[model samples]
Target: VIRGFSNSRNPEKTIRAYIQMLKTGFSPDHMTYPFLLKSLSRLLNRKLGGCLHSSVVKTGFVWDLFICNSLLHMYGTFRDRASARKLFDEMPFKNLVSWNSILDGYAKCGDVVSARQVFDDMNERDVVSWSSMVDGYVKSGEYNEALEIFDQMMSVSSSKANEVTMVSVLCACAHLGALNRGKKVHRYILDEHLPLTVILQTSLIDMYAKCGSIGDAWGVFCRASVKESDVLMWNAMIGGLASHGFIRESLQLFHKMQESEIDPDEITFLCLLAACSHGGLVKEAWHLFASLKESRAEPTSEHYACMVDVLSRAGLVKDAYDFISEMPIKPSGSMLGALLNGCINHGNLELAETVGKKLIELQPHNDGRYVGLANVYAINKRFGAARSMREAMEKKGVKKIAGHSIIELDGTPHRFIAHDKTHFDSEKIYALLHLLGTWMDLNVNNDDSDDYHCVCS
Candidate 1:
């Protein structure tokens, strides 16, 4: 009965069964602990897991490899890496599962250095080991490192890359906008005849869309089997179209999605709101915002932020301000920043000052707020106040974050900062820029000829 309860999907029943077993004076055996540990992990009941650990030690099952591994996994799931590692070190004999569990614990805790150390120390590795390392790097925003590891896995590792590995690689490609590499992965998938699972197809669409290949994204969406396609696939395509400025197409897709039996989730509305903001559909945005409640989905900060952007961009700054004032949740920095930007654009200095003060209070350490406020003051010829804002930022020790841009070339991402000359081809790049500047000056001179003639006449 305890085994049945533990193996069942319901965690509450599992805990209740354990309680009943305890009341009946039935001490659980070694075989019983793994499934119970799994239930504790699923429930995220760390306190209960600790109690179970104590009981396991009392019963002399702590040395049991299966029980220890399960305990390690549970601690990892709880983000208690120290405890997991302690258990790992105490093990008399370690297997592949034991090593993988500890490595996963470190990875899940964002301890990439420790995970790498474990990976390097491992005598033998399976596909899971490689996938964990790659996925860890991907999660930690080390896309380049993740790709490099994947290359090593392909060239050196005997274990073949699986769907999990492909998913993480595709996610990295999407984030880096590495269309060249993403396309290569897609081609590899085709060459291998790997099943186009829902997740794989969704990631493919997202990768293409984010990489600015809307056409390829659409192709993948169209080719997906209807039976296999789900709401996430539809959301990805809609979001892709909207982000690429095909707002009308995105709206049409949203309507089609509504016609389907699948109900829209928060993400669907987020995409719809983004489409409305980009298309400047003020009326449509309001309607969609109202429809979110009808769908029984609460408005998240991102949803509100999008609405604020839509209103602000439409020159409805006052209305947006009122909306923020009446929001059930407190306004986030991005929402206020959007309104502040609109004020700067529309030359509404008064509202700009108001929003600027709120923004500073909310994000006192953010250098962008001070800079933006200074720009607003300068635009209004309030030179003293603008200088004061900068002085205040310096006093507060807030340094402006240097802006940078990324461009992918030949499947590698290159990052550049303003006035930076660190690239190997900096001299050649500067030469090309100088030539472009001369060409621009020549065009300006040509356009000024008519003005010169009028002055002479």
Candidate 2:
């Protein structure tokens, strides 16, 4: 009953059942501890978790690999990496699970360097080990490294990548836009006839969408076995099309999703909302926004922001303002900023000032809000107000965050900033930029508009 309640996500009920068990003199065993530990970890009751840890230690079963692994996982989940590492170092008999536990700990804690060291030292590695390393690389935003490791895993042994490994690698590919690598993975799946679980299919759809291969994403969606077309699959397809500006196809798929009798979730609404925004379908956006409640999915602030963006961009300024005013949750600075930016874009200076005031009031110390407000004023030729905003920013001691852009070169991230000279090839890069600018000025000036000049910096 305790485990059932816990698995059902009813923590309070689980605690009650556990208390009844304890009062009946039913001592909890090791198996009982993992569930309780997870429940406590989920609740972030670190105090009670600490007491449970000491109790596990007192039971003299600390050497038990299962118990120790659970403890390590609990500590890591609770952000107690130091304690997890201490327990890992003191463990007497270490198995693959034990090693993987600590590796996962490091990965979840964002210590990918240490995770790589442990991975390199492991005498044997199974699917779990590879998944952990790949996940670590992905979490650290080292997408290329993750794909390289996936390649290395395939080369070192023909053990075959599992679902977990594929998911992580695909996620990295999605982030990095490694379309060629992703295609290779797709071919491997086809050749190996890897089992196509709903998750794998969903990941493939996501990967292709991110790689700018919506056609391929559609292929995956079409080939998904009938059972695989769940709400998640529908969301992935809708989002893939929506992201790529395929409004007609996306809506068609959305209607098909409805016909399939699969209920939409918050992600589905988010994707459709994005589609509406991209296609400038204001009426459709409002309909989907209203449908969210019927789907039993409450709109998040982000959803409201998207709606506001759609309405504002379509020149429904008053409606957007009313919507934000009536939002159940507090509007974030970004939410109001979107409306302000739209006002600037469409020359609605009065509403922009209102949004600017609200944003600065909410996030007084945030330089971006000041910058946005100033930009709006500058757009309207209100130099005095823009100058005042800048001066107020200076008086508040708020510094503008450095502007930088990261581009990957040969699988390594290279960062460049305004007037940055810290890189080894900074001079060479500047010279190249100058040459490219001159070439474009001479060769392409007549063909392209001044809009291309925005990237000069």
Candidate 3:
């Protein structure tokens, strides 16, 4: 009965059964502690876990390998890394599972430094050991570190990288825009004949698309479509094509998706609307936007933002403003900012001023809003208003943040900012830029002269 309740899906019942066994004078042995600890962990019952830990010590099961591992895992799951470490250190005989469990505990607590320390201390590591560290780095937004660990795993480990490792590595490559590295992983998958699970396939498609290889993305999509008809896969393909400005292909896929049994979700509509906006298909955008209601998906602020972008880009500033006014959800700063940008592009100073004021109120700490509005005033020759805006920002202690760009060269990422000379090859880079500028000037002058001669003739 105790084991049955412990193995049950419900943690509450497990605890009750344990209590009932204790009341009936039945003492739980080492075999019983793992399940109870797991139940406590699942229920996030730290107090009960503590009580159980005391019982384990009293019953002389403190050194039981399985029980200690369970206790370590429970503490890790609760994010109590200090207690986990104390337990780990006190253990007389440490096994591979003990090392991996503590590593996972530190990683789960967002302490990658400690996790890496644990990882480096391991004399012999397996797939779980490597995967935990890689996944930890990825979750912490240290994509470069994750990629480096994956490289190390590939070079040293005899154990094969599984689907989970591949997915995490692909995500890192996607964010870095490391097309060369992404392609290498793709080739590795093919060479190894790894089964293309839905998640692995989706990650591959997304990685190829984000890395600027639309053709490869489409090929993966086609291959996956033949065996798997999941909506997420279709969404990835549609979003990828839309982002790359392949609106016709994106729309065709959307139509094809509708023909299949897979239903469209909110993300699918967002991609469709974005495609229409990029392609300047105002009519098609409106149709797709309205179709959201029929598909039983409520329009989120993101969906409304996409519509505003579509209308604003089409030079319909007034219509975009009216749409925002009627939206069920409050317009976010990004939504208003999109409309403000459109107003600036179309020289609609009146709407720009209105939207800019609302945006500033919504995001007062954002220095870009003040700067953008000040620029608008300066463009319209309202020098006094522009000066006041800048002064206001200064008084509020808001400052413009420096902008930077990242470029990946030969699988290595380089970052550049205005006036940045940190790169070793800065001189050569600047000289190349000057030569490119000179060439562009010559071509522009020649084109103007030819146009002038043609008009006179």
Candidate 4:
């Protein structure tokens, strides 16, 4: 009964069954403790789990591999890496599951370096070990590292890359915008005859969309839709189309999803709202927001922010401000930032300054916030105010972060930052820029048309 309850949703019932068994004088042996430990892990009741650990020790089941592994998993879930590592070191013998649990603990904590150390130290590894490490790197935003590890896994490990591995690798590809590499991964999936599970489909759509291969994304979406479509797949397709400026297609897909009786989730609405924002479709945005309100999905802060962006982008900065003022919850940094952007774009300097201060206050450490406000003032020729803003930022020890851009060329990413001189040909690059600037000045001024000579920059 304990095992049955534990395997199902209700950990509380699992505990009750265990208590009832104890009252009936049934001692928990090796067979029973693993389930009980699983229950505690699900409940995340550290107090209860600790007490049960003591009881297990007293009951002489501490040496049981299954129970110990369950304990390790429980600790890993708790993100108590130190405690989990201590327990791992104390174990007389460990198995594959044991090592994976400890490695996952480090991964969950975003300590991918430690996870790699553990990975290197492993005598043997399976898909789980490789997937955990790859996923850790992905979660930590170490996209290059994730891909490097995946390459090593493919070259060395006989264990097949599972759905989890593909998802993580595809996520890495998406972040890097490595279209060529993403295509390779897609081909690999096809060659391996990997099942296009819902999650894998979502990752594929997301990868193609972010890599600017919206046509490919649409193709995948269309193919996936031939089967009984899930909400996640629908959400991914909608978001992909929406982000790529295919507002009409995204809306059509939403309607198609509704026709299939597939309910939209929060992310679904967010994607649609983003689509509307991109197209500056104010009426469409409001309609979707109204629908979101009528449906079971409560509007979150991100939704509110997206609405603000929609209004702002359409030159309704004041309306966006009023809408934020009427929100049930306090405006988030992003919510206010959208309003500030709108104010700046619409030339409402007074409101821009006010919203900018609020945004900076909400996110003091956000370098962009300080820079945004200062740039607004500088653009408006409010030199004193702009200088003051910069001074205040310096006073607060908030250094403006150097802005950078990355472009992937021939499957390699090149990053350029402000004042960066790290590249081997940086000197030549700066010389070319100087030549271009001189050419632009002479040609732009010598233009016959007066309008052509009136350059804003």
Candidate 5:
């Protein structure tokens, strides 16, 4: 009963049953304590888990492998690395499971650096050990590091990568926008006959979409069994189409999804609303927002912010401001920031000031808040106010992050700052750039329809 309840959704029942057993003067044995400790870990009841640890010690089950493993899992889930490490070191005997448990704790708690240390110290490893580090690096936004680890898993370790490991690799590829590398991953999955699970298919769709291969994304989407397509798969495809400006196609897919009885989650509606926003369909966005209110998924702060973006993007700054005024929840920084952007584009200096200050108060450390307000002041011919905004930002110790763009060429990323000439290929790069700029200037204002740089706008 303890093990059953521990594995069930309501793990608290396990704890209650154990307490009843104790009150009835029944002593739980080694077998019982493992399940009980598992329940505590699932519930993340820190104090209760500590009490159970003491109980385990008193009952002489602390050395029990299963119980100790459960305790390590609980500590890892709580991100209490210190406790996990201490118990791990104190273990009279340790197995691979024990080592993996501690490594998992370090990684889950956002200490991938320490997790790597434990991983390196291991004399032997399985796919789980390798996958953990790759997944950890992926979670930490160390995409390049993740890719390097995966390469090593394939080459150095000669370890066969599994579906879960491939997922993280694909995710890293998607983020890096490495279309060639992503394509290689896709081929590997097919070559290995790795089951094209919903998650794997969704990752492929996202990777192709972000890598500017929407047609490839569409191909994958079209070939998938529509009956077996999950909501996440649907969301990924719809989002991909929407992002690529296939707004009508995305809407059409949404209708098809409804016809198939696939319930639209919050992300689905957000995708639709964003498509409408980008397509400048203000009326359609309003209708979609109204539909969201009627759907099972309630609008979150992000949904509300997207709606504000729709209004602001369409140059309806005043309407967006009124929408904020009537919102049930307080305006988030992003929502107000959208309104502020609308104010800038529509030349509504007065409201921009109010929104700017509100944003600053809400997020005092955000450097963009000061820069945005300063830009507005400069635009409004208030030079002194613009200068004062910068001064205030400096007084608050806010520093604007340096802006740069990373472009991947020939499978290598080259980062460039504005007016930077530090790259080894700077001379040739600048020569070509100069020629392109001169050609564009020559083509500008041309009446020919074939001209690429015609400045009709």
Candidate 6:
């Protein structure tokens, strides 16, 4: 009964059943604990999991490998790495499952650095360990590192990479625009003639789309062959098409998806809404945005922000204002900033000022909103307004947050800040930027696009 309940994806029911078991005096044993922990992990019930940990310790079975492994898994699910590491350190014996659980915890926590360190330390690694690390790197958005690991693992052991490894590698390659790497992986699958499961096929299509090779993406999609694919597969194709400026095709596919009886999820609408935004289809975007409820999807803060962005980009300043005013959920800082940015882009100082104030109310510590408002004033030649904003920030003890972008060279990431003098090549980079600025000033003057440089409006 505990196993049955734990296996259930409904977290509330799972937790309830476990509590019932405890009430009945069926002290959860080693076999019982993993399921309870798993359920707690699935529900992200950290408090309940901590209670369970105490129960295990009181039972004097904290050293049991299976229970410890389950505890590690629970910690991993919630990214409680400190607890997971302590548990790992105290394990009487470490097995493949044990190591994998800890590695999975680090990976899911977005600490790929720690996960890779664990992978390197493990004396005996099975396919699960390698696959977990690869998956972690992919989720961490380190596609190049994921690919490198895949290569190294293959060289060490000739075991064919599994669907999990392939998925991460494909996703990473697509994100990095490594068309050649994507093509090579696709061909490897073809040459080896690995069974094209639904999962693998979806990854293949997504890879092609992300790599900007729509032709290849379509070929994989056509080969899906099933009369009805999963909604996620449809979403991938739709999103991919929309990504490359094929907004009409994306909408057509959405229509076909409905006709084929594949029910859309919240993610589907999010993608569709984004496509509408990029293509300036304000009417269609509004229709689908309002239709989310009918599809049994609630509008998250992200969905609301996307709508604001879409309306703003299309220059529907009044409509965008109304949309925010009537938003079902409280406007988040990002959503308000999106509107403020759009106002800045369209030279609507009034709207920018209004939205900028709301944004400051929502996020007091954030310096970005203040900077954005100042930039809008600068664009409008309202230098006094801009100066007042700066003064207000100074009075409030708010400092402008330094901007930084990261670059990776030779497998090492380097961070650069505006006018930074910290990098090894700082002198050279600064000189180059200065030279470029001088060239731009010499050849181009007072371009309106400069106002729209990073402003969404």
Instruction: Score each candidate by Cα lDDT.
Output: 0.91, 0.84, 0.90, 0.90, 0.90, 0.84
TM-score winner, 2 or 4 = 4
lDDT per residue (tens digit) for residues 1-457 in model 2:
7677767766767667777998999988878877877777677778888988888778776677888888888887787889988998998888888888888889988899989998998998888888899999999988878988887888896568888888898898788776777887878887988888899999999989987889999999998875557888889889999899899789888888888778889998888888887788998998888899777888887798889888878777778899889988888886787788778877888898889999999999999999988988888889999999999999999989888866655444466788999999888778888988887778876775674533432
Please write out the lDDT profile of model 3 over residues 1-457, one tens digit for every residue. 6567666778778888888888999999988999899888889998988999999999999999999999999999999998999999999999999999999999888899999999999998999899989989988889899999998999989978888888888998998899999999888888988888999999999999999999999998887754376878889999999999999999999888878867899999999999998999999999998899888788888999999999998889999999999988999987888899899999899999999999899999999999889988998999999999999999999998989987899897777999889998898888877876876787766654554222110
- Model 4 lDDT tens row, 231-264: 8888888998888888999999999999888999
Please report the candidate that would top lDDT against the real structure: 1
Clashes of each: 0, 0, 0, 0, 0, 2
Candidate 2 error regions (>4 Å): 1-52, 120-123, 155-159, 394-457
Distance from true location, Cα of 85 in model 1, Å: 0.9
After TM-score superposition, what is the CA distance of residue 390 in candidate 1 from its true location, in Å?
Answer: 0.9
Among residues 3 or more apart in sequence or in different chains, the pairs in candidate 6 whose N, CA or C atoms overlap within 3 Å are 342-457, 345-457
lDDT of 6 by residue, 1-457 (tens): 7788777757567667777887988777788787888888888889989998999999888988989999999999888999999989988898989999999899999999999899899988887788888899888888778888988888996567877777888887777767777888888888878788777888888888986789889889987865747987888899899988999999999998898888888888988999999999998998998789776888788888889989889887778899889877788887788788788778788888888888878887788878888888888888998898888888999998788866544434466788789998887776777876986887655654463232111
Model 6 score (lDDT): 0.84
Candidate 1: tens digits of C-alpha lDDT, residues 348-430? 88999999999999999999999999998899899999999999999999999999999998899998999989998788888
Output the better candidate (1/4) by lDDT.
1
Whichever of 5 and 6 has more lDDT, that candidate is 5
TM per prediction: 0.95, 0.83, 0.84, 0.92, 0.91, 0.79
- Poorest 10 consecutive residues by lDDT, candidate 4: 448-457
* Pairs in clash, predicted candidate 4: none
lDDT of 5: 0.90
Residue 285, candidate 4: alpha-carbon lDDT:
95
Candidate 5 has a TM-score of 0.91
